[model samples]
Target: MADHTIGTVADIPQGTRKIVVLEGIKIGVFNITGKFYAVKNTCPHQGAPLCEGSITGTILPSPPGEYVWGRDNEILRCPWHGWEFDITNGKSHYNPHQCFVKTYEVSIEEEEIDTVTVDTYPVNVEHGKVIVTV
Candidate 1:
């Protein structure tokens, strides 16, 4: 596994996401409530650009005649098929067990790094950059 610097925290504000390509693999990095999360941009249903979808919440289950809106800005919806997924876990809202999108680990680097080794060579980078591990 290797770490790739996607962008800075300021690049993606809170409740927003940024699409990044690491080694040709497109991934979506999201910032929710000051924390960071990442998921593959490919939707499991039809390979749609999942990250490009809306960053909104969904209607939760309620009583027979009631509906509740919750998880604001934590849902990632596929623009192609309306497939909804949790940005925090990349799990499909329909069926979490069998249907889901690939997720990646994200980290915020604040330490002074000597060099960033990507693939094989070292790339010079500064601190406080968001890194996605693949």
Candidate 2:
């Protein structure tokens, strides 16, 4: 497995995202509730940068008669076509059968955060910035 140190936990604030380029791959790092997740920056539908998309809540169908507003869930929508994707799972809301982005394993050690990949690509966090090795 390729282990990479991405960045510090404080580099990415809650409800915010940052883009890191690694080995020609544009990665979007999001911080939600003090946790970190990394996924491909490009959207599946229109190849828009997911990092630049707006972060908003997901709408779900409520029970009949009684109206219930869905809670604020974080999602990234493509800027070009407005296709939404779950940041946690990298799944497209419009097309459940296909997934265009791949997520990497992220972990925190001391003050640094690391992003790991199946392949041997190095990634690490330093000085509040993520450095990816191709």
Candidate 3:
């Protein structure tokens, strides 16, 4: 796949998402705890716009009659049918490997600057700018 630069890390906040259209294909780029993930905007179930769906946590059964919610902003719920999908790998909650949405690889490009330390050792430190390539 060809690499496309969506934006810098500052463009997307720590708990938000951005949608980028590449060659007529809409892809969702999400930022969860500073990590980036990309997924196809179309939902597998009914072709709904998946990226427009709500980013929420999963509901788990804590006991016989109790339910607990966790993993906030880790799950994407389809707006049409409420189908939950993992944003990290686009794995559907219902049929993990059998049914799922398409996911793209996301990478961060950082520039390095050379500097000298007190011990006379050369050090390369990352600049503030971060390029998000997908």
TM-score of each: 0.79, 0.72, 0.78
- Candidate order, TM-score descending: 1, 3, 2
lDDT of 2 at 58: 73
At residue 43, what lDDT does model 3 achieve?
Answer: 94
Best by lDDT, which number? 3
Q: Write the per-residue lDDT of candidate 3 for residues 1-134, one digit (tens) a residue.
A: 68888878899999899999998899999999999999999999999999999999987758877789988898999999999999998999888988888899999998455786764444454596544433
How high is the CA lDDT of each candidate model?
0.87, 0.76, 0.89
* Predicted candidate 2 versus true structure: per-residue lDDT over 22-124, tens digit per residue: 8788988888778787889887666788768777767577777766544244677777778877777787777767764677777778853467757767899
Query: To one decimal, what is the Cα RMSD in angstroms of model 2 from the true structure?
Result: 15.9
On residues 11-84, what C-alpha lDDT tens digit does candidate 1 reach at each position? 88988888888988998899999999989989988888889998889888889989899999989889998999
Q: What clash count goes with each model?
A: 0, 9, 0
Candidate 3, residue 89: the lDDT equals 86
Which has the higher TM-score value, candidate number 2 or candidate number 3?
3
